[model samples]
Target: MPLCFQELVTPLLIDGAVSPLSPQSPLSASFTSVLPYHKDSGILSEAEAKKAQKALADGNLLEVVFAAIETLRRVPSTRVNIAVTGDSGNGMSTFINALRGIGHEEEASAPTGVVRTTQTRASYSFSCFPDVVLWDLPGMGATSQSLEDYIVEMQFSQYDLFIIIASEQFSMNHVMLAKAIEEMGKKFYIVWTKLDMDLSTRMLTEGQLMKNIRENILENLQKTRVRKPPIFLISSLEPSWHDFPKLRDTLKEDLSDIRYHGPLQNLFHAYKEIINDKVTYLQEKIATNSFQNTPGMRDIDDLAECLKTYRLSFGVNDESLQQLARSMGKESSEYKAIMKSQDLQAVITRGWKLKCLTCRVMKMFLILLSYIPSLDALIAPYIRQEKHNRMLEGVAEDTMTVLKKVLKDFTSS
Candidate 1:
């Protein structure tokens, strides 16, 4: 590591961020009271405080603290860091990109390729939020290493989940990874890749294929001595092909609630709430303060500035939202009912009501120009008038007005 990077990543190698936490440290307050485990379940909660206590009590306070900090200090986004590993041509990279909502197989949103990709643990963050990284790791094979080495080296517990990719039946490698993850009390799932290829061959119907896949997963788990195993069937080409939403829901459900979900959500909520509380407190103080030497004029100016900032932040600008809504339409599909209604109106009314308004505005502007009183004197007789400029401006303005109307009508109706 470079000198600067060494300083930056030193915290990750130590215990979770709690070991060096001083009472006055910037991030200390977050870990002091909170715990990683739940009160009722006694499992590590998401809160840094509780995890820190666990570390201290176990005499491995440094490790837990570092881990907690790593989780908390992690980019403020839901990146489910999944280590996807399977045999060659299994489509692990393609699956990752699809899950993150990227485009085609070759032009995946996540990084992948056939260069023995991901020789080391490399993270591919979601475009929506870079913090949600997916790790494309080296495929599993028979190497002279114990399962414990795999668990520790990979830091299995730090990941939100594990996605074991396989094209056909869950293989021995997948079974080993799954069993190890289970033993370590972590979450893992099997993703059956290349389903499209199988379907093309007419080997089995979709339903039959799914049943066989499930049975194979069970068989693999049994072979590995795992009692029960959870599996997800997926095709990167069709991220929404089969139970994608269900898969997402299951992962969220399995996370350490108090430590991962509850504390994370709470931290964001609390940060916002604290800022709000401070604003309320200041308002009360101002209201109760004596008028003398209070600099009321300055206060009024500050209040106006504050109100302006608040309005800009919270109050939606219909114009901007209309533009955004139109841009969004380019990527997203609109409701059939709404699209049908608009198309009908466009046919009957010659595009939209705003088209009429546009015509009126155009006619009015032309009428004003007519009053220029120059008649033929203002222009050379050979300079023929062209409606192109007027038409272009009118079309642009009309489009904006139509977008606004569409947005308003949809929101209201």
Candidate 2:
């Protein structure tokens, strides 16, 4: 399976010998302490933490984490299909060409002209988005076929997004297409093309012309019972002007939403599953090995190492952050500045002696509690598991932060 965002960092989190399973373990002591502050940390709700603890006791932690990782590995291969359709002379082909960031005369450009150029559906790959495919369907009402028949023939259900183009005024065909797309529960945008021609012929000012066109389109769409569909007015001859830039940005944002809902949803679920499973695994470990001894310098060192690994695994390490900066066209320092978990190593190292002192105090406390009958058996495990859960929660939050930043950069690009 492909490497998940969590998998890439799991090795770092689990590396080195700190368990009693290895007698020659580098750790100085079996340091286990359930700090009191973790109880109200809000890492996991009481119900959820109890559920995970139960799962751990049942020995099903590995199975759960593995299943979630498998689901996350499928996200990169998800495909997105977008369909662009309109009347023959409404500049659908030109819009497709412009969207692909190429001139109409370019070899890879979609053919555009006064005549019906796209006789059959053609697919084009977006250079910036490897998994996205754009389909240019022949104009509606080009032949004897009705609009409904044309939609069926084009297999409209295959596309995730639709762009319906119109020239001069919003026609019945545009409204029908918008309504059909809306009914199908898909997203569609209306593009008013040939705006330059209207500006030249109409008596209204540019602002008034755009306002009238937008109001008219919205009015027509309302009649068809299509609510709040995005509308853009632009001259194919001057796509950089008017609403073209806004159109591009809005489409990218909408596509980002579709992409997230399609595959990222699975990844998100997997993330939650892995987090819960990790909590369960840690709770099991704490239950199995508690009140053994006081943690010394070696235990503190091991924890510091673990913190370093956590940072690296989540792509927040200095090297990883630098590489991400280069890929996103930002400075490395900018990423480091925004990253909340970058001080993991420093926090561990700077507070080492104090942490060690606290661990020794916790060990003494556990020893005293053990004398108080059943309190040690019940309270020690719960406290330790809560502390472990809080640590894991911080790591999970950092992972999500990095993932969101990467995704935003990708979609915007």
Candidate 3:
């Protein structure tokens, strides 16, 4: 179903049941909401916008992820195209092979050589990461094309992320590439590959050498005013040794965010626009209509009812979530996993919105609005719209979260 605000408040369940989430504290019975994003910063960057709905339809993982999403989100399959680049002979191809658990001799492994074996851009993939393509772009060297020329030739804008590889020492090429990538508002990592060669030097012990390498890379980046990103010290040949595993694991872990970054932002933006329009309409309708006998603002049951409203809106209350869990063949409690906070402040403030009613704030806001009849004849009507809109948004976000988990469950191995 194409997502619409009206469909929600009264949604027809999709073909499949979706999935779960987090923590606990004193459940405050108040109407508080976390708006997804602000108006000015809401829209995604150009690059991210290109990665979503439009591009996902053509992405490699679409068939599988699209099907799963149809049952819940109906959005596109997220893709993360990572470009691994460096000067010739920096083991860029070797790193790609290692990351995919393949050797140079294996089929589809990125070609490696003492010279520039990667003549043009080539890509590799790993199982369960169909949407993640590791591009083995032709190496950039001082004697070769200029940085500007190389960037255009490589179509740098197409890659979602970058991995700048270096060995022996940090070069001006690497530093320049990193700075350029950063300037473009993209994330890049400094992977000091060939760790074996760097470690062989006798001047420093292993730990000292590692620290020295990190400092040297850091210093080079610092001079150029480049943001220090995760710098991995790894030997592509010995993948399991050094930081190769950590780098790979980190890369894999980051894909979750990388994948959803575009689609989720687009979805959130669209949802926000829909909700904003609804809030405006609701505010007007509420100001005119008779909202009879909503328990007096002072009633304690009003707080309880409001809490239930919020919970039911998000489909997070115990009974509904339990039924969802059961329908999905999952443990009901799994959907409500709580992480106990040991911090006193956090423990006390946790769920403060769910447990306590902020009636005073509501009353005060209404009293203030009461002075402005031009705003609303009945201040309570405006507050009702405020509460309903906030609750609607919270519900929308929770729905997106569940959709994400469900997609993950279907896509991940």
Give each model a TM-score: 0.42, 0.52, 0.60
Q: In model 2, what are the clashing residue pairs, if there are any?
A: none
lDDT of 3 at 80: 75
Candidate 1 lDDT tens digits, 1-413 = 10010111111132222233221211122223332333432223446544434433222322332443454545343445667766545777677767666654444455566554555566776554444567876566424556667667767777766788888656676777787777777667777877777678767889998888788788768876886656777766766667565676554445323124543444334322322332333334334432213332234323333222221221112222233334334221332223221222332244443344345575575467566757534531112122211222232233233333333322222
Taking all chains together, the TM-score of candidate 1 against the true structure is 0.42
Per-residue lDDT of model 2, residues 141-259, tens digit only:
67779877998999999999998999976888888989999999999888888899999999999999999999998998899679888889998777678998888778767766776
Worst 10 residues of 2 by lDDT: 2-11
Model 3 lDDT tens row, 143-165: 46799999999999998899998
Candidate 2 segments whose C-alpha is farther than 4 A from its true place: 1-74, 267-413
Best of the candidates, TM-score: 3
Ordering by TM-score? 3, 2, 1
RMSD of each: 23.1, 12.7, 11.5
Candidate 3 lands at a TM-score of 0.60
- Strongest candidate by lDDT: 2
- What are the lDDT figures for the candidates, one per model? 0.47, 0.61, 0.59
Provide the lowest-lDDT 10-residue window in model 1.
Answer: 1-10
